[model samples]
Target: MPRKSNTDVLALFDTLVYTCQYRLVLEPASHVSARVLEWRQGLRERIGLFHESYHMPSIILCSTELPPEYERSLVDAIARGSEGFASFNMNIGGVQHSEDKRTIYLEVGEKGIIAALRQRVVDHVRTNRRIKKLGVEVVDHARLVIASGLKADQFNAAWAMLAVQSVMVQQKVSDVVLIKRELGDTSMDEHVRTFALTQGV
Candidate 1:
């Protein structure tokens, strides 16, 4: 059964900026990167099968809600601050469901590279006076969303159990992409402007 399209502008906005999220875009290692590609494809297929598909966004490392203007400044600061950090590798562990069961995602386990990278970003954000005023906090456990919104009993319990079992696997992280949500419709190359973490690593 195809899920019905329910495009609520308010809802979409809520989801987009529900919290100000700091994310690192996940990209395949190279043209010949088979392992990571396979894992990503499998997640997409499983989400589609359940009629719970949604565009998978980048991995969010930390999130918070902020005043509109403050959010903009914080993003700019992050861009500047990120320029000092080098790109690092991350590891994907397995699949898990959000506590509310609203989202399915891949678990990101922290390695030394990722840990140091995250700390650097967190420290910069927290210490910045403008950002500090917003009271935004950083969180551990970065994850890539696979799908969101599932109705209980839409299928047997075993369906979700099987789905989780089938696609749980690990892979290497190759790239980090930073993105920001645009406020209104404008002529822009990307709906979310992505910045590659290329300075340090």
Candidate 2:
């Protein structure tokens, strides 16, 4: 066996650093997504400007950064975590803001379904000590973001405009998506993998 120089060992350590971000999300159907987009456009026009670009409507469960080597194990963890969960129907409606009021989104009606799945995934993935230390914030509240990076006036206007109207759209959530992007990628472009839930008899 040959011995490696210090430089080789340093290079190997650098490669192991986290280089990609992973997001677990529940995406709305195409038709539902269209409606949400329309709603966002309405808000944009009313508010006179929107701070951020558009993204497809989805309820994010959790997100974290990890090294590329862990990707396969993460997929396997998600698969095992999602086992036995049945599909459920949910309504996307109502308007809410984050505590800072910098972001606005549509509220997801059926919260328990997402909460249960998040718990399962956290359990499976966090079993690894390496991942456990990293932040895996699976918040209790789930939402489909409309517009973010809002100014004080923009937030008030958008919120008031949405709060008055009844905006309920229903859709069936059958699967969760695992999305990944490189460390420096800011655009929404990424690889998406779906894990379908078990069908109920």
Candidate 3:
């Protein structure tokens, strides 16, 4: 699905600020990539499972004042993975605001690979057991969706109205991971908590 539909815009979402999440990006041009796009765009509306429980963890489980940027290693690893996979650069769709979720999301160019990546992330997080209890899943693939809440609704609305046109340089995906973001007075830093694929290899 196109990741920016409002939980407020033609979406049925309850009002609440959720916390915590697990996320990963996919290589757009991968082998089964075609299936993902066909499913998300064409078949999703017909599949009740797609909309009912397929919401991204970042969208429904976590709240962030800041949007997530690719980790330095993640960026490099993805570039390296491009040799074996079909990679597409990350694009910022826009700031999307619903009733309360002022989320900034990255648009998936190769929606298929992104979907596969999501499932892989779910499998990886499950090994943690503890985090598994947190109830994060990988079925619904999306790059990222950090909430801004009502405080930044105006900014989100302004951006959401704008169309997505910018093209980004594609990157590879050597690894997928779950990271913990700790907030500071003026900034936040990520600490790698678990790996969905390879960490050192």
**Candidate number with the higher lDDT (2 or 3):** 2
Q: Which rank order by TM-score, best down to worst?
A: 2, 1, 3
Taking all chains together, the TM-score of candidate 1 against the true structure is 0.52
Give the clashing pairs for model 2: none
lDDT of 3 at 143: 45
lDDT of 3 by residue, 115-191 (tens): 55444334543454434443444345354332223235443443443323232334444444334443322233243
For model 1, residues 1-201, the per-residue Cα lDDT tens digits are 676456566456546653433333454334323433454456455443332222234555554445455655656655665664555545654667777766666566654566666666666667667556546555455665555555554223423543544333354553445544433222121234344567443
Which candidate should be chosen as best, given TM-score against the real structure? 2
Tell me the tens digit of each residue's lDDT in model 2 across 1-201.
Answer: 899999899678756765677888899778767877787779867886563344556788888778778778788888899988998988888777799998888789888878998899879888776666655767678888878888899888888876665667788888999887665423553656799998867
Model 1 misplaced regions, further than 4 Å: 1-55, 98-103, 148-175, 180-192, 199-201
Backbone clash count, each prediction separately: 4, 0, 4
Model number with the top lDDT: 2
Worst 10 residues of 2 by lDDT: 183-192
What TM-score, computed on C-alpha atoms, does each candidate reach? Answer: 0.52, 0.78, 0.39
Q: Judge candidate 1 at residue 94 and give its lDDT.
A: 62
Residue pairs with colliding backbones in model 3 are 28-110, 78-172, 78-173, 89-170
**Of 1 and 3, the candidate ranking higher by TM-score:** 1
lDDT of each: 0.50, 0.78, 0.36
Assess candidate 3 and give its TM-score to the true structure: 0.39
Flag the better candidate by TM-score, 1 or 2.
2
